[model samples]
Target: MLVKSLNVLILIVLLPFFVKAQTCGITNIALGKPVTVSAEQQYHVGADAVDGNVSSGWFAPGDNNYIYVDLGQSYNICKIKIIWQTDGRGKDYKAQVSTDATNWTDIFSRTNNNASTDSFTVNGTGRYVRILIATRVNNWASIEMSELEIYNSLAGNTRPSVSMTLPANNASFFSGANIKLTALANDPNGSISKVEFYQGLEKLGEVLQAPYTFTWANVQAGTYSLRAKAYDNQNADSLSLPVTIIVNPSTRWSLLGNQGTNPDSVFLGTTDNKRLVFKTNNAERMTILSDGFVGIGTSTKPNAETKFAVNGAVYAKKLKITQTGWADYVFNDDYRLPALSEVEKYIKSHKHLPGVPTTAEVEKNGTDVGEIQALLLKKIEELTLYIIEQNKKIEEQQRKISELENKEVNRN
Candidate 1:
C-alpha cells in the first residue's frame, strides 16, 4: 500500500514535467541491471538500487561505503537521480565514474541532504559507476537508497517489437464464438508500457503483462485481420504483422476433419456382406439386411426362406398371425382325416404328433407357436371324429347281441 501510494504521488509530481522530459532524451541506463556493493547483506543487494521501483532499496549498515553499477556497455550519461528511503536518507554522498575498479573520478558531492530524492548533473563516459555514502540523516552508520537512475540527454530510443501468438494465421472458427487475442512484446532499451490489440483499423483492447491476452466475444461471421501495437516507456510504438481468420455462420450439423465423396448413407452400425449390426453394451443387439430382413440379438444374414430371425425370446401382450387356411377345415366332409392307428404309429416313430416338430427340432431351432396351435387343433378335431366312429361300432355290436338272445328264447 505504501509503495502504491508513493508511485501515485510520483506520477502526479512527474506528469506535469513529462513534456520537458521527452526533450531531454534521457533514459535510465541502470534500471533492472546488474550492480555491485561494498557491503554484503540479504536486504542490501546493490541490484535493488537500480531496480526501478521506489518501494525497494539497497542498504549498507556502515558509513564511508559505496555501491557500483555495470551499464553492460559504455554510455555518455549526463544526469543521475538518487531516490532514498524516508526512514534513513543519506546525509552526505558522492557520485563517481570509473573504467576500472581501482581508479575513480568524482562528479558530484553533497552534505546535509535531507530530501527523499536528489538529482545531480554530471558529464561522464564509462561502463561502471559508483555512489559513496559519507553519513546518514541521523549521523548513524546506516545508509539506504531506494533507486538510482542514470540518464543521457543526447541518446535516442528505439521502437519496441510486438507480435500476435494466438488464433493462428489463416484459422477458422464458428460465428458468435469467443475469440482470444494474444501477443508477446519486448523493448530493447526500455519497459513496455502497454500492448493494444486491433481488428483491421479498429482497436479492441490493451494488456500490459506477458503472455498478454484479450478475449473478443460474440464476433459476427466474417473474415477478420488482427494485429497488436506495443508502446515503450519512451512513447515510441511498433505494430505486429496481421493474422487473418474466417468465421462461418452457425449451423445445426457440422463435420470434423475432411469429408470427401461421403457415403451414400451413414449408418450407426457395422456392415459386412450388406448386413448391418446395431450394438449395445459392446454386443450386437439388432441387425438389418439389404433385403429388408430384420433380426434382434443377432447379426446373421436372413435368407429367402426365413425373412426375420431372432436369437432371443420376445414378449408381447398379444400376437396375431395371418394364414391362408385354419383348422376349421378339418370338419369338412371332404377333408381327409388320417386313421387313429396311423397317427399312433407316426407318434411312436417320431416321438411327437404327426404334424408337430419333435423335441430335438424344437430345442435346436425353437418352436413356431402359430404352427403348433394349428396342428394341435387339427389333431383334436380328428380325435373327436375317431370317438364318434368307435361309439357307432359298439352300439351296432350290442344291438346284434340282443337280437341273438331274443331268438334263442323263442326256440326254448
Candidate 2:
C-alpha cells in the first residue's frame, strides 16, 4: 500500500505535463511558427498565442468577440487547442475555417463550457481559422484566452501564377484589325489545366493548349483592361495583373518606300473630316474626297465628266472595252460608205484625220488606246469596200475592150 501510494502521488504531480490535448491522426503543424492573429481588441497582444509562451495570450473585448488566425498558407487542419486564463472561462465558443480570409464555415461549436484548457476536434482544412465567443463566464462583457493553437497537416498544393504578354500595357491599335492576346503561366508543383482571358469583368475566351493565345477580332474602339486567369490540375487558380489598352476609331496607315525616299502615308483629311488623304514626303499624292471622288496628283474635286482622274501616264499590256456598241456595224450592207474625196476634204479642213484627234489635241489630252483602236478598224473596213468597187469597174472596162478587138479581127 505504501509503494502504491508513492506511485499515485508521482502520477498526480506529473499529470499536467503529460496531458494529450488532442488525438488528431496528423501532426501539429502550427506549433511555434509565425502566424497572423487579429482580434477586436487585445488583452495584451494577440500575437502572444502563436509566440509559444503559454503564460501570455489574447483577450478579446466584447461578447460575440472573435480571434482570427492565418496559418500563412493552406493546411489540412484537424484540431485546435485553446488555453484560457485562470479567470477567463467561456460559456459558449465556436471555431471556423476558410481558404480565403473573408468567407468562413463553422467546424465546431460548444455551449455551457467551464474549463481552463479546452481541446476541440476539428475536421477542417484551410489557411485561416477563427474562434468566436458567444458568452463568457461570470457574465463578463468580454471574452479572454491565454493561447490559441491549431493542429494540422500541410495540404501540399500550390496555385498557378499567370501574366499577360501581348497587347502590352498602354498599347494602342486600330479598330478594324484582329488583336492577338498572349499569356504565360507557371505551376510549380503541378500541370496547368487552362488559361482564361478577360476584359474587365467579362470573360473573353479560354485556351487549353500550350502557347496559350487568343485573337480578338474587330474589337470596337474603347479602353480595355486585359487579364488572364490560370488554373492548375489541382483546381487552384490565380489572376494576372491587368494590362490597359486603347483602340482607335480611325486607322492611320503607311506604305513604306525605298531607303532615303519618302513613304506613301494616309491620314484623316484636315479640310473634310470624313475624307482620307494620302501623302508622299508630306506632299499630297492622292486624295479620296468626301464626295467619293478619287483624284491622283491633285486634291481638286474631279469634274462632272470624269469619274477617275490621273495626272500621269499609264502603260498597260491589254485594254479591254465593254462598250454597248462596236465598230462591227461599219460592215453592215446598209451602212453608208463615204466617198474618198469627201474624207479628203474633211481632213484638209480639220488638219487631222477624218475622225481622229489632231497633234495639238493629243499633246494636251492623252489618247484613249481602246477608242483609237476601234476608230482605226472602222476606217480599214471602209477602205476595203472602196477597193472592191474599183475592181468591178476595171473588169467591166476590160470586157468591153476585148469585144471591140474581136469585132475588128472579124472585119479584117
In Å, residue 114's CA in model 2 sits off its true spot by 64
Summarize candidate 2's per-residue lDDT along 143-216 as a digit string, tens digits. 66777888874345567989999989999876555889999999997788899999999999999967999998
Candidate 1: the clashing residue pairs are none
lDDT of 1 by residue, 265-318 (tens): 433434555777678899888778777678887667545667788787778899
Q: What overall lDDT, based on C-alpha atoms, would model 1 receive against the true structure?
A: 0.81
lDDT: worst 10-residue window of model 2? 256-265
Q: How far does residue 44 in candidate 1 sit from its true spot (Å)?
A: 4.0
Best by TM-score: 1
Question: lDDT per prediction?
Answer: 0.81, 0.77
- Name the regions of candidate 2 deviating beyond 4 angstroms: 1-278, 281-284, 287-293, 297-303, 348-350, 357-371, 401-412
